[model samples]
Target: MQYYYGNQMPLRLLDEAEFWKHQEAEHTEVIREALNGLEPEYVQALKEWEQALTETHQQVVSYVETVNRMGYTFEELQEQVTELIKYCLDESLKFIDLCREIEANSAAAKDNPFAKTLLNHIIRESEYFVGIARIILYGHTPA
Candidate 1:
């Protein structure tokens, strides 16, 4: 999350969204792989999450390709990029909620120290993305 794209906020935000969403989708597999004895409900939930995250990741990738190819300045495409950022923000928040639920409610997650810690880490990563998205969309983060 570098502000290196001082004039390319949309590209920067899209790149971030693309990377994190892909990571999150893979994280679902990581969790699934680690917890062989996980409950069926939790496993199914993770599978659904993986699919959702992957779809979001692909959407972000499409945006990135379009933005890079079109060469539009941030001002030219701010509205569309803003909508994308908002969608990403909502997705990240929902992901954090799901991770928190697993950490708090899943017996499998509760019993495995690794899974619990990993869930916390995953939530923090999504929160970090949310914070970045807020800063970009609102020009400042709320206190």
Candidate 2:
């Protein structure tokens, strides 16, 4: 009774914190089982998505640190901050698009545990980036 891409599917088990905890776990058993009968292309796409997520996360962190220690005159810091904000916005948009793509491709599939996990990670990382971006853009820490 496993569902595929085009099949109607049941509501996912949604225990927000627990679901995220499961995703954060290094246990690959669920992913391995899910991928056991899938196509190589899906596997390859999943790897690419994971790499993109990691790279984006690193870039956001580096940008935030750089902006924090800019140590420049007002005008110079302003310009640099503008550029950093633009970069963050672009990265955020890209991250959101990737999440949407993953959700669309895997939502109906019962064997998409890996995709689900990756999506959850991407979402959490994206939110983190957004928070940092806001702090940089607004000069105010979130309350």
Candidate 3:
């Protein structure tokens, strides 16, 4: 996706990834219904996801200020961005783990296909951000 930077994001997957990541709001109903009969813990997991995502967003905003207005040295900016990336990765991994727990044994499995599909979509999005972080840390861009 043009909105994401990563070392291994395949060109063909860009549009699909963009649709899922950037346009997720359009499919809220589908997601909502998918969890209709699921265990409430799944709902709680999603709440955690929201919190994690919000925290990551805030970190990014703060880091942007540091880079733009605070006049951070290049190394300082790099360190800050790296910290932000680590925070995002840590939070995303936690959410994914929670999803796996819910998926393993819950009412969410009632519609197994839908539940798995939704989980996969979320996992892919998280992976994309992690990829960007890893690429940046390695000091290179995709070719």
- The sequence of per-residue lDDT tens digits that candidate 3 reaches over residues 3-59 is 353422232122232233333332233445666676665665565555555555554
Cα RMSDs, all models = 1.6, 14.9, 6.9
> lDDT of each structure?
0.85, 0.45, 0.52
Best by TM-score: 1
- Candidate 2's residue-wise lDDT over 53-140, tens digit each? 4454454455445534653344544564456455644556564564555456643334466666655665675565555555545655
lDDT of 3 at 104: 71
Better of 1 and 3 by lDDT: 1
Lowest-sum lDDT 10-residue window in model 2:
7-16
Q: lDDT of model 3 at residue 82? A: 55
Worst 10 residues of 3 by lDDT: 7-16
Specify the highest-lDDT model's number. 1
Candidate 1 at residue 9, lDDT?
A: 76
Cα lDDT over the full model 1: 0.85
For each candidate, give its TM-score against the true structure: 0.90, 0.44, 0.65
The model with the greater lDDT, 1 or 2, is 1
